[model samples]
Target: MSGYFIYASLHQGRPALEIVDADSRQVCLQWEYGHSASQQTLPERDNPAVDELSESEIQRLFRRLLLLSCRQSLHGQDEPEQNS
Candidate 1:
């Protein structure tokens, strides 16, 4: 309850997954889909203290995002993957 939580929400009218700090209730990372899928850091109105997060915490967030992506693919959403 004192760490980060992942939420499925909309960011700028697009489907998004957000990693929010439970204590500050601020978004630290966001993965959103629009013309393409992309990841943004500190997408909220005010930036969260991203520097405070440890490397493992950040990795956890990315792992969760990957898991969600895999699930979406398994469901056959027809979303195209973008190569950067």
Candidate 2:
């Protein structure tokens, strides 16, 4: 039988998820959501809007980042609301 597990990743200190399968002597897996997103068949960048942004967009991103920093706790954990 197969088992599923949801783990809150602590590597990148960002929004991350992991699902592990269990049913064999040695089984492990990680669906790297973006191993090479930049190499996608389409021309769109991984984060197209961020990669190609105007002055206003850049400022907006900075503002958001600042807001997030403020909401983050001492444990490096940010409130769910501040996460993407």
User: Which candidate number maximizes TM-score?
Assistant: 1
Candidate 2 versus the native: TM-score?
Answer: 0.29
Consecutive 10-residue window with the lowest summed lDDT within model 2: 27-36
In order, the Cα lDDT scores of the candidates are: 0.58, 0.41
Model 1, range 1-84, lDDT digits (tens) per residue? 345687887766756677776767887567554222233434453545434333444565678668756654675554665799
Q: If candidate 2 were superposed on the true structure by all CA atoms, what would the RMSD be?
A: 14.1
lDDT value for candidate 2? Answer: 0.41
Q: Give all TM-scores, in the order shown.
A: 0.33, 0.29
Off by over 4 Å in 2: 25-35, 39-48, 51-84
Question: For residues 1-84, what per-residue lDDT tens digits would candidate 2 score against the true structure?
Answer: 434454655444332344444434332333222223443222345656534433344455456446534543443444353556
Stretches of candidate 1 off by over 4 Å are: 1-53, 79-84
Considering every candidate listed, which one attains the maximal lDDT? 1
